[model samples]
Target: FDVTFVNKDNLPEYVWANSWGVSTRLMGALIMSHSDDNGLVLPPHLAPIQVVIVPIYKNAEQLKQISSHIEPILLQLKEMGISVKYDDADNRRPGFKFADYELKGVPVRLVVGARDIEKGTVEIMRRDTLEKSEAPLEGIAGHVKALLEEIQTHIYRKALAHRQEMTRTVDTYDEFKKEIEKGGFILAHWDGTTETELKIKEDTKATLRCIPLDGDTTPGVCMVTGRPSKQRVIFARNY
Candidate 1:
């Protein structure tokens, strides 16, 4: 239910519910949480274009040859249910395409020039790490599939690590106030009362984000009121 733990005439009732669909908030969260200096850093599974192939060539003939070579690779990737984009438009340069796709957060990018074709390889770059390497074109599709999974996992772990680093535990109201100013989640004991919660918010401008559903639930006393508290709640200025 949208409204939980409603109180009526000094009586309380619980409502357990969930939201099934997603909204624009999911998109906002994706961009805000994962983006960096270069641009968006989308997880592979979430990226609309998981892989973008950019052709590097000196002339029209070279572009035609490169496109012909990449046709089979593109078909292979598509057959494996991977989204791919082959951008060979002469209107834009290769560097511009690279930067555009990087900003768009394409998970993986493959660059194949005449020289790379002669060597039977392509230059691959990962958006999350911006690391580039050359890989043979023979099994390039499978290599890309594996690399996408790796990128997904790497970005997820990186974001989790950042969250863990930002979370802090505070034992005193004064410490909570100090920590909240620095930004990030603060774990602090809170008396189960509206008065104390409101007072803390009024004084420090931090709100109780949640009474964490799991983890270290050991009993403790409220930092602000010194009342017996069951567990620590999460507090933050804003997400």
Candidate 2:
């Protein structure tokens, strides 16, 4: 059913949008595009935290004491503009939390239990590469901030490289299909007609994602119809 609401005593313009119902599918695409057999490799900037602090304890008293100590540290980190999460949940094991956080792409994790407290340090784990280091409890906020920035930059560069490696230009339908199967954006000539667009979609399942913002205005023949074309349009099977 379509419901209408009056705004300022006038009808508003109706905008149409398409959906693939692929929110879960998009996550799958990200995993396929970015992950290895080990697990997900999330882009650092998109990661929930550059740092996560997990406190381990054996009993209620120990948990309370550890939490009390960590609160000041968490506050300091927050004051310094660092995003931090302290996992004190009793429902899950430390190993499970570690694995789950890594899968979710948290950049850094710090484990502070009774043992680490005795040593006046915390176990800091890097999620991107499973790297671990010991960081002193004092002055940890600044150190974490710097490390998170580094991870963010590193992930962006890696994603850019992956995109570059996957993209290609094609001149023929046969070549276009071959590259598209490998999964990436394709640049090719089009006849600029709805009929040609429909035919291409019928054959390749590809659609015009957009007439790109900066397409070159050059004379060419349409790959499908052999019709004169002013420029090429971008085509892709979008999410």
Candidate number of the best TM-score: 1
Candidate 1 lDDT (Cα, 0 to 1): 0.92
The residue-by-residue lDDT of candidate 1 on 90-148, one tens digit each, is 99998999999999999999999999999999999999989999999999999999999
On residues 1-239, what C-alpha lDDT tens digit does candidate 2 reach at each position? 24455667687644444477468878786677666555777665565565678889999998998898899989987887777788899999999998888777777888988987888898887766678899898877777888888776776677779876766777777877777776677877888788888987888888876676677667788776677877777777765
Clashing pairs in 2: none
Least accurate 10 contiguous residues by lDDT in model 1: 14-23
Residue pairs with colliding backbones in model 1 are none
lDDT on C-alpha atoms for all candidate structures: 0.92, 0.77
- TM-score of the candidate numbered 1? 0.89
